[model samples]
Target: MAQQRDPRGSRALKELGDRGLYWFDNTLARGAAALVGWLALLCLAVVVPVSTVLVWTDPAVPASAPARLAAVWRLTGETLRLGGKTGPPLRMTMSVLLALVALLYVSLLVGLITTAITDRLTELRRGRSTVLERGHVVVLGWSEQIHTVVAELVAANADRRAVVVVLADRDKTAMEEALATRVGPLGRTRLICRSGPTTDPALLSLTNPATAGAVLVLPHDEPGADAEVVRTLLALRTLLAHREGGREARPCVVAAIRDDRFRLAATLAAGPDGVVLESDTVSARMVVQAAGRPGLSHVHRELLDFAGDEFHVVAEPALAGRTFGEVLLAYATSSVVGLVRGGTPLLAPPPDTAVRADDRILVISRDDDAVRLEDCADAVEVAAMAAGRVVPERAERVLMLGWNRRAPLMIGHLRRSTLPGSAVDVVAAGAVGIDRSDLADGPRSGLLVTVHEGDATRPEALHRLDVGSYDSVIVLGRDPAPGDPAGEPDNDTLVTLLLLRQWEESAGRALPVVAELADDRNRVLAPTGPHADVIAHGKTIGLIMTQICRNRHLTPVFDELLRADGNAVRLRPAADYVRLDQETSFATVVAAARRRGQCAIGYRDHAAVHRGLGHGLRVNPPKTERRTWSALDEVVVIGA
Candidate 1:
């Protein structure tokens, strides 16, 4: 029948079908498409062969081959549908059993698919997604300074839409929680947090450094933080090199190096346009400067904070060709402190120095938009007060309490600033030692140094030192004991401050005391007396880092101001610059300082200092305004 039709070809066709099935089963077990593949295999393996066997064994089944195939198809479909009214009773019973098995297999497949989806979601939350934002500020690494930096950036861009993305080798949820607690609300700034190793190039890309407006590298407080910062810079450089347009199209980078030794290396890694700050040297110098002037810490804080008056650079064509002295009185609501020309900052330049057309005036104001010049029609007349005698430099006795890593640097700075015959006495519970050999051959070789071991917080130690005899007292914040929290250092500092205040009260004489603090929050706990000058270490460093990030030109200006051999910030007697108890314009004071080869920026009122208020430290005062001075007042000047 039909020429005994091709038995060999039919057998070959059957064998090909069997081989295809075997291949499909293996592929399903290996590939991601296994779920659908396994489901198909399960239906075919359980229903197709079983349906064929049942129809062939049944005597009532169709006799022809096509009829048998149709019966098999109907049975397989009925099994998947659970049961059918038109099917034979026996066939329907069998369909129910096969349906239960299929249902069990489908449940297993659903469970596996759900687990796969959950794993992907978890990975995404771990900060593996690529960022698509442009012009955002990217902060690399995490440290205590992050809160201050973010807060400052938020305040700086409060009126505009901005984004700040933080990438660190910390838990994403933990970082977000810390930020939420420290920074309560960000008005117009959007904050994003990602968790990854900051030194890894691939991980660094998660913050999209190529498109960022600026990248800030924060140094950890632990040992070897400088190395970590340097590594991060290198990683950023690598990413920049691979960017679409290369280095020129890369974002600006700013980094802080705790150790001065690594500054050059960090700078190289950051490229010529990037900024690398020497944080240790900056903090030491600031502490020394604050120690010399009792109320200087407050002045630094005001200049560094965004909530108060901050430094801003603005171009003013109308001010071009005018003298620095004339431009000082140009702004009604702002104070011109210096001039920025060719990207270099010149603070308190000579009064005769002319402002160029391309120069930008560095002004202290509430905001950049608020820097406006007004007509000087209502300016007060400049009256030359009778000149007073210059005060002679004299040697004095000083007392230092407590000790830390910064003690030696502070001592060296003290030596450089004080007269040769001056003496410094250091007392602390721990071993207080410094290399006095270097001082032996310097100009300050004559300065005396004494070290004593005692608990500074005790009443007996205060009495033994005869605190009132010293011209000034410096209390350095103590390091916390092992296992103690960070705030403990500040707590000890506060206690020492209270004891000093008591000592001054009992001695019935105001003692000039400059107290160093580890945390800014403890500043409020300090006694509200003129004798207590509180300087927060963390706040000072935070402000410096923020300033460098905002403008790199300030680095050299700060270095010069804080260096021992360069121009320094000094509070000399007001009488040395101008006559006392007579109304005189600041312009006359400027002239007097110029005569001495010094630059006068402001003056401090001794009366205000005695009242524990900072209203006395008047910086960038209007040049045409007339004010009376006292013998106790000090003129703020930048001098040799």
Candidate 2:
């Protein structure tokens, strides 16, 4: 304060310093060449003076200023690698010129080498390099389903070495990390990720789709995902056509579209041989099916996933003339469900149907390696076989909580599957864009639908609806908003499940609940009783896609299995197939089911459920294995 020295002067100096810094930064930003030139000049200015002082300070140095200056030049030249030779002016000039020329050549070579290395590294980091593989699986696009698809592929290939190449419009490292977290160990499968737009044919070629055995076009979980899937399929088709060069054979393409409107477009783009699945329709069908049967979702999950017994088509030339009923008990470890004849799958064919030499028997077994034929017909107990017949279908009431895009389809399927007297009470917070006129005039007229505006997650709303009065409950999750995070849709479903569980606990009776979740991980968080079923829409679609990729013929099989009118999987009373409280081998159960025109694959034991033994379910058990049949036990069978 005492020195109130020129405040304006200080401000001017500060501004001048800032301008100098700005100039220096701008100069350096010009180019690498300019930066190097400045670096060289600055280095020379400091090195020369330091070298001169050292030379003059040395006790043995020449006293003349000219000699000292020459010594300094020699020292500076050597330090800067510009020729340190001390000689006559002409010789010094030649040495410096040669040194400069040599420096220039070395700098140019080093720059070329460095630039080449950098470019190659950048290409690698950017995931632009092409994958060189044969018979590998090429996956186009990325979504939540990618994890399930890749994991199933890995498990399906655990017996042999295989490769799975993924090309998506995402960072390679990020994709790798996400997959690593979702899909644990990859086993014998090798995964390669490339980053680029899947709609670009040039980028699609990075995965070598032509050489791939199968290509999966995954649709993202967002608006217009079906459109994007259609585009990717078109690009892939173009790439494959270019690579085929007039060849008729093409790689198997499996794709899915969320909306039915784009299903035809995706199918056309995928070619006649390709498979296009309507994911929304399938999900809706599964939810309705699960609502009718509590443990049906688990059975479907077991059949779709690769961890347990799955469908396998094997040739049994030795038993070509054998009847379908005899073939049912042919394999002690495998359960024969149907056969593939003339490139078509016939599930639960007539018992009298003869197995042709060209036909492949479709059986559910732990693995293809376990589909060995053994005589188990002798294990059957004729006395334990039930003489019961199929019962008549009855109408029931179903309660639907929450709503989404799949609700209308679910209602449609429900209406078709249920009898005319069946009623469905749909309780949602709002109408959710439903057209009331369409439901009353169309095929949906068979089933009476009542809309109630109430939040299903609230306990008061559920209590008011007389939650325990309904025969079955279907929990449909709401769709996410425009900028919602992944799995956020499942929150409402989980809360409703908890409330339902609380109601069950207070009432001292288990409620039959089937929930549709957006994320598979959220399934674990759901509070479920033995009768509750949680179906993850993404997992179901992913499993179906991977199944088609493994064997394209199974598309029809899945289509029929998910349909209510077709030979669908059902959980019937064990007493329907076997005598209650009687000890009999599973082969006896299988034989009894065969007589009833059904295929018994497994059984759910109510006693085992109380004991927590594999949730009281066993699929593809040995035919020779015997167990006591209780009325509480239900037989898992595929029937019409």
- By lDDT, who's the top model here? 2
Q: Point to the candidate with the largest TM-score.
A: 2
Evaluate all candidate structures by whole-model CA lDDT and list the values in order: 0.77, 0.89
Model 2 clash count equals 0
lDDT per residue as tens, model 1, 1-640: 5567798999999999999999877886787668766777788799999999999999998799877887887787777665432356677668767776777788789999999998888766677677889999899887657888888888877789999999988888888888888887999999998889889999898889888888999887667789999999999999888886564566778888876689999999999889787765666677767654676666676677777777788999988898887776677667666788998888777778999999999777777887778854245333444454666778878888888767777777777777778888888886545444533436435668787898888888877877777888888876545555656777767778889888777878777788877666677788735745787766666676667767767776666766755666777788887777888777777667765656666778878866756547787666676788898888877766
Residue pairs with clashing backbones, model 1: none
Once fitted onto the true fold, the runs of candidate 1 whose alpha carbons sit more than 4 angstroms away are 1-113, 244-249, 375-378, 384-388, 432-444, 479-484, 564-640
Q: Which residue pairs does candidate 2 place in steric collision?
A: none
TM-scores, each model vs. reference: 0.78, 0.92
